[model samples]
Target chain A: MNTVVRNEKYWLMAAGYIGAIFLWYASVKWLPISSFNRLPDPLSVIREWLSPDPSYGISIFTSDYYVHIWYSTYRAFTAFFLAVLLGVPLGIFMGWNAKFREFSGALVGLLRPIPPLAWVPLAILLFPGVEPAVIFVTFLVAFFATTMNTLVGVRSIDEDYFRAARCLGASRTDILRDVIVPGALPHIFTGLQIAMGAAWFSLVAGEMIAAQYGLGYVIWEAYNLIQYPTIVIGMATLGIVGFLSSAAIRWVGQRLMQWREESLGLGG
Target chain B: MEQVMKRDRGSNNSEGLAPRPEFGKLSIRNAGKTYDPQGSAVVAVHDCSIEIEAGDFVAIVGPSGCGKSTLMNVLAGFDNVTSGEVYLDDSLLASPRQAPSPGADRVVVFQNGALFPWKTVLENVTYGLLKTNAMSRASAEEKAKDFLSRCGGLDKVMRSYPAQLSSGMQRRVEIVRALVNEPRILLLDEPFRAMDTISKTTMHQHLLKMYSTCRRTIVFITHDLEEAIYLSDKVIVMTTRPGTVKLELTVPLPRPRTPEMTASVEYMDLKKEAIESVHEEAKKAFERGERELA
Candidate 1:
C-alpha cells in the first residue's frame, strides 16, 4: 500500500517534466511570436542530443561529450574535496577556540561578501596556468560555504550536552571526539551538500572564462558558433550531473547519520 | 508491593557485586549565588544551607524562580556560588572564589534528557567508565549491560539510539547512565519533569528500586510536593527568589516504598505541611513575577 502511494507520487512528479516538454514543443510550433520560432523545438534538441553523427561536434555518442563531462566532474570533485579537508577543521577550530574564532571571523567577514566570480581576474593573475585559476575560484565559494555552515553546526549544539559529557568523566579530547563531532555531524553534512552545489555553480562560471574544456566552456563555445540546440544540450547535461552529484552527497550523509533518520521515522 | 517484589527479582543478579561504602556526605554552608554581579546583579540563592548524609535521599522543593536549580548547579560544580562554601566528605567542593570542575564523582541527570543522541544506550552507559579510564572497554560493556538489565529491563534497547526509545525509556537510560558511573553523589535537576502522571509514578517506583540497589547519595530538585514527600528521606522547602530553607520535613516512612502509601494519613499530613510552606512562597513569587513584568 505504501509502495503504491510512493509510485503515484513519482508518476505525478514525472508528469510535471513531461508537461514542460509538451509546453515547449507547443510554444515553438503554435505560438505567434517570432522569438518562439527562432528557438529550437524540444524534439529537435532531443534528436540532436541523441544523434551519433551530429551536425555539431558534441553528442551523447561522441568522445567530446564524455571529455567535457569528465573535466567538469574532476574539477568540481577536487574543489569539493579540498573545501571539506580545510573548511571542516577551520570551522571546528573557530567554534572551539575563542581566539581563533576572533582571528578567522574577521578574515572570513572580509572575504565572504565578495562574489566567487569576482576573484576570476585575481585568480588568473595569481596562478600561472588556467587550470589552477579556475580551480582556485571554484574552491573559494565551496570553502566559505562549508566553513560557515560547519561553524554554525558547532555553535547550534545545546550546552546540556557538554554538561552531560563532563559529568560522564569526558576529558577535553573525549568531549571533542564523542560529543562535539557527533553532535555537529548533521550540520556538517548540510554544509557538505551546499558545498557540492556551490562547487558546481562556481566551477561553471570559472570554466566559462578560463578553461579549455568542461560543460560551461562547451555552452559558451556552442553559443558563439550559433549552435542553439547544443546550448540546451549543455545546460541539460550540467543540470543532470550537478543534481546527481548532490544526491550522492545526500546518500552518503544518510548512511553516516543514521541516527538522524531514525529520529525522523525514516529509518529502522 | 507487587512492583517492589518484581524489582527485588530483577535485582537478584546484583549479589555478585559487593555493596558500596556510604561516603557521599554533602555539606552546604550559607551558600549564595548571584548572576551578572557587575551589571544588574540578580540573586538566585542566598544563605541556603543543606546537609545530606551518605546513602540518604533528599529532595529540595520551592516555588518557581526560588533558586532550587541554582543550588543544584553549585553542588554539581556547573556553577560557583557567590558566597559561602560547599564540602563533600571534608573536601572543599565549592567556595566563593573556587568551584570544582564537573566530574564523574557527581553525575547529574538533567531535567530535559541529555543522552548523547548519536550513541546507543550501551555506549552512553559505558561512557563515564571508558572516558575516566576507570575500566577497560570489555568490562565497561559488561557493567553497562548489567546496569541496563537491572534498571527496568533496558537491556533490549541497549543498541538503540535515544530517539528510538519512548520518553520514559530515555529518562530510564539517563538514570542508568548516571548510575553506571557509581558517582559519589547523584544530582537530579527535576529529572522527571514534563512526564505524565502514569509515567512519573512508574518512574518513582523504578527510582526507588535503583536507589535501594545502589545506595548512592541523591539530591533531587523538584517542585512536585507529592514527589518530594514520596521518594525522599527529607524534604527541604525554600522561600521565593534569593531562596533560603524555609522548612525541612523528615520522612519516617519505611523503604521499599509502595504507591499505595501516597494516600496514607501520615503522608497527607506531610503533604499538607509542605503545601502550606511552599504555597506562601509561590504566592510571593507570582507577585514578584507580575511586578517584574510590569
Candidate 2:
C-alpha cells in the first residue's frame, strides 16, 4: 500500500511538470510581438522526437535524434573526463600541503576571476582545433573553483586531527593518504560539482563558436536554417545532458562519501 | 590494593638488583618557554623543575594561563623549550624522530576527547596500532574489543561517529584509546573538565582503577584543587604568567581515597594551602600586567 501511494505521488509530480510545460507553451503561443518565434507546441515537439524522418525508411532508433544525442553526450563526457583529470589533482595539491599552497595559490587566485569564455581568444590562438578549444575552455572553467574549494576544505580540518595522527606515528605520506585526503573529500566533491556545471556551460559556448559536431553546433545550425522544431530539440537535449551529468557527479559523490552524508547532514 | 602490589614488586626488584638502584624518574631541570621574541615575548613557563618517579600520579594545579598546559605539552615532546631539559628515565626527552614506536610509552589524552569524527570508537582505539608490526589485524581487533569491553562493551552505538556520542562518552573513548596502547606515561590535560559532577566522579574512579592495574606514570593537569587532591600522589602548585613551581605537596592520604576525604581536616588544610598558593600567583600576575600597561 505504501509503495502504491509512493508510485501515485510520483505520477502526480510527473503530471504537474507536464502541466506546467503545457501552460508555458500556451502562454508563448497566445502571446504576441517577439523577434523569436513561438516555441513549437509540446505535442508537436514530442511527435517530431518520436517519428523523426519516418518516411526515410530508417528506424526511429537510428534517426538524427540519436545521432545528435550521441554526439552531445560524447562531447560532454570527454570534456568532463578531461576536466576531472586536471582539476582533482590540482585541487588536492593546493589543499593537502602548505608548500604547494604557497607556490600555486596566488597564481590560481589571479587566474580564477577571469571567466572561462574570456580565454576563448587564447584557446583559438594556441589550439585552433575544435576538441582542443572545448577541452581548454572546460579545463579553465573547472580548475580554479575546484582548487579553491579543496583548499578551504583542507584548511577547515581540525588541527587536533593532524596532531592525533602524528602522535599515533603516521608517516607524512600515510597522513596525506589516510587522513588529509579523506577529510577534504567532501569539499573536493562540492568543487567538482560546481566545476561540472562550469565545464558544461563553457563546452556549449566553445562548440557554438567553433565546433562542427556537438549539440551547441546543431542548435546554431538549426537556428540559421529556421527549423524551430529542431532548434527546440537541440535546446532540450543540451538542458537534459547538462542536468544528467551534474546529477551523475552528485550521485558519485554521495556514494563515495556516504558516511559524510549521514554524519555531516550533507548530500541527502 | 594495586599500590600494595606495586610496592611489593618494587621491593622485590630492588633486592634482586646486582649493583645500582634503578631510578625510573622524570626530571625537568629548569625548563623555560618563550613565544615570539619579536612580539611581546610572553613567557609561558620559566625555570620550572620537578621530578616524578615511575608509577607516580602527579597533578599540576594552578590558575588560568599559568602554563600548566604548556608544561604538559613540553613533557609530551609536542613543543620546544626555550632552555633547560626534560629527562625521562634518565634519558633526555626530545621530539619524536621517527614513526611512533609500538607502546609509544607516552600517550596524551587531550581536554577535548579529540576523537577523529570520521572514525568509529573501535577505529579510534586501534589507530595507534596501525603503525606497529607486532599485532595482526585480527589480534589487534580482538585486543581493541577487549579494551572497549573494559570501557563498557560496544553496543549499537559502537560503530557510530564521534558526533553521535555524548561528551562524556567521547572522552571515555579517548581515554580508552590512550590506554589501549599501554603507554608508559599517560598525560591528561583537564580530561574531566567537560563532564557533569556524576560523570566526573565515575571517570575519576575509572581512571584510578586503570592506573592501579597498569602502574603507569600519570601526569594530570587541572585547576581544580579537589580533583588534584583526590587523584594525585603529589600535587605541584604553580605560579601564574611566567609559571614557576611554587611547591610540591605530597598527599599522605591513604590509598583508595573516598569522597569523605574531601571534608576531612587534613584534606581541607591541603586544599587551603593549594588555594593560597594560586591566589598569591594570581595577585602577582595582575600587578605585573598593570605595570606593563602603565
Best by DockQ: 1
Show pairs that collide, candidate 2: B105-B184
Residues B236-279 of candidate 2: C-alpha lDDT, one tens digit per residue: 99998788899888776655667778888878888888888878
lDDT at residue A175 of model 2 (Cα atoms): 75
Could you tell me the TM-score of chain A in candidate 2? 0.86
lDDT digits (tens) for residues B1-294 of candidate 1: 455435533442354422444689999999999899579999899898899877778899999889988888887888999899999988999998787789888999999989999999898999999988669899999999999999879999999999999999999999999998889899999999899999999999889888888778899999999999999978999999889999998875566678999888878988999999999999999998999899
**Model 2 / residue A14 / CA error / Å:** 5.5
lDDT of 1 by residue, A75-119 (tens): 999999999999998998888888999988999999998999999
lDDT of 2 by residue, A34-126 (tens): 642366777766666566363222223545656756766776667667766777777777767679888987887788889878888788889
What is candidate 1's CA lDDT for residue B146?
96
Off by over 4 Å in 2: A1-23, A32-37, A52-63, A264-268, B1-24, B37-40, B95-103, B154-158, B258-261, B283-294
Which candidate leads the pack in TM-score? 1
Q: What overall lDDT goes with each candidate model?
A: 0.89, 0.74
